[model samples]
Target: MLQASDITYTYNGGLKLVFPNISCPTGQHWLLLGQSGSGKTTLLHLLAGLRTPTTGSVSIGGTDISKLRASRLDKFRGKNIGIVFQEPHFMRALNVEENLALTQSLSGQKVDKKKIHTLLDRLNIAHKLKSDTSALSQGEKQRVAIARALINDPVLILADEPTSALDDKNTREVISLLEEQATAAGATLLVVTHDNRLREQFPNQITL
Candidate 1:
């Protein structure tokens, strides 16, 4: 489960963005909607533990991540929080399999080839295991990103504008895939997007 309260952030330029509290229980799915400059991404970062909120508490699975030391927070995030960014970033030189393996290594886990293969197979990208990440099509890369996020069986999955660029059909497909994967992992899924088409897809929604 994920819980956040009194969340607020201040940009270096003196801009302050306050966010609503979020309480998403385990295995639940929620959608967060807002416009382009509505701080959707900022809130996602705070919830993911990528950025510290100016004032507030963020707890995941009963651990107050906001107060954790930098080193411990890094480890905790690696094991429990999975984030799929609007743009997938990968080491250009690494193959698909190697990229996923790197995530495990960073999290202090030994590379699990079998798990990597199994996840890729489920995402329908097993054939691209040896392919360079840059060589995959946009859709394929997004699928790989999803696979990477699920590789460690994170308890919380936070996706930022995952389907913003896709057509209606692809949007539905990607949303379905995210929901299916999160359910399989028993993880709480929170998607932050400006896409209103998704409003109907997730009944529990918060608007900024």
Candidate 2:
């Protein structure tokens, strides 16, 4: 569902970061493994169209996203891609449900309360719907972020260091939640992290 051809990026005044070619098929789950400063997160951002590449192309579901106009890219990304960041950034004043509702509105998609409730339930955060985001624990907040990512029913899911702050159990739970939901929705999942503990869980790996 996603392909990156001859991708290259440079920073720190012409220092090249790893930008080898990469590709993944539909329904595949990929783990991008690399240590600090290895360009794992950079590659993830490029694939998600959050960062434009200096050269080469990133195509998602057959469209060359790197070539899209800024306005068109925003709309296409909202509908085709979902991202879970290392830190779950939510509106401090909004409740869980409200935060998710706002996400739907921002994406220009109709709100589906049932789908929202079902995703929260799947992530074991259904009871926290009425709770303010500021009152939740880190793990709880992560679950909420996952729910928000799934709310749009995106075709490609990209997660960056999602398990960084979680304990072993929570890490497993978070990975399981992402894997299960992505597979059920027929969305491609790409998780970028330095966590080797996850290797046993996902056999496929793309090391940078």
Candidate 3:
């Protein structure tokens, strides 16, 4: 479902961050592991098309996203890719459901209330649908973040350092939730992190 080849990135007046080619098929779960400076985040950003690679191409479902124009790429990402960052971000003024509705609308999708409710229900956060984001506990917040990422039923889900802030129990729960949701949605799940504890749990792994 996703592929990257010959990837390299460079910051202004700095060294290049090179990455190995990555390929993941549909409905598969993958772990991307690397040390702190190993370009894992850079690689994830390139795969998500958040940063255009200095070299090589990223392909999703056979489309070469590297060749797409910025506007088109943004739309394409909105419709096809879902990302979970290390720190979950939400509009403080918006309630949980409103934030989800806003995300769908930003992607040019009309609000799918049924979809939103179903996603939150699956994440066990249906009760928080009308609550302010600041009111959620950490685990609840993470679950909500996962819900937001999956709100669009994206074909590919990319998570960066998702387990970094959690305890072993929460870490396991989050990872399990991500895998389950990806399977349920028929989307590819790729998590990039320095958390070695995840190594034993995932069967498919790539190191940078």
Give the winner by lDDT: 1
lDDT of 2 by residue, 1-208 (tens): 7999988887759977757777888988989899988988889989989889888999999999999988889888888898999999899888999999888878888887787888898888999999999999999999899888888989999999999888999999999999998998899999999998899988778889
Q: What would the per-residue lDDT of candidate 1 be over residues 75-193, giving only the tens digit for each residue?
A: 99999988887888799989999999999989878999999999999999899999999999888889999998999899999999999888898889889999999999999999999
Query: How do all models score by TM-score?
Result: 0.98, 0.96, 0.98
lDDT of 3 at 29: 95
TM-score of 3: 0.98
Rank the models by lDDT, top first.
Answer: 1, 3, 2
Instruction: Give the clash count for model 3.
Output: 0
Q: Candidate 3's residue-wise lDDT over 158-206, tens digit each?
A: 9999989999999999999999999999999999999999999899999
Off by over 4 Å in 1: none
lDDT for each candidate structure: 0.93, 0.89, 0.93
Clash count list over all predictions: 0, 0, 0
TM-score of 1: 0.98
Backbone clashes counted, model 2: 0
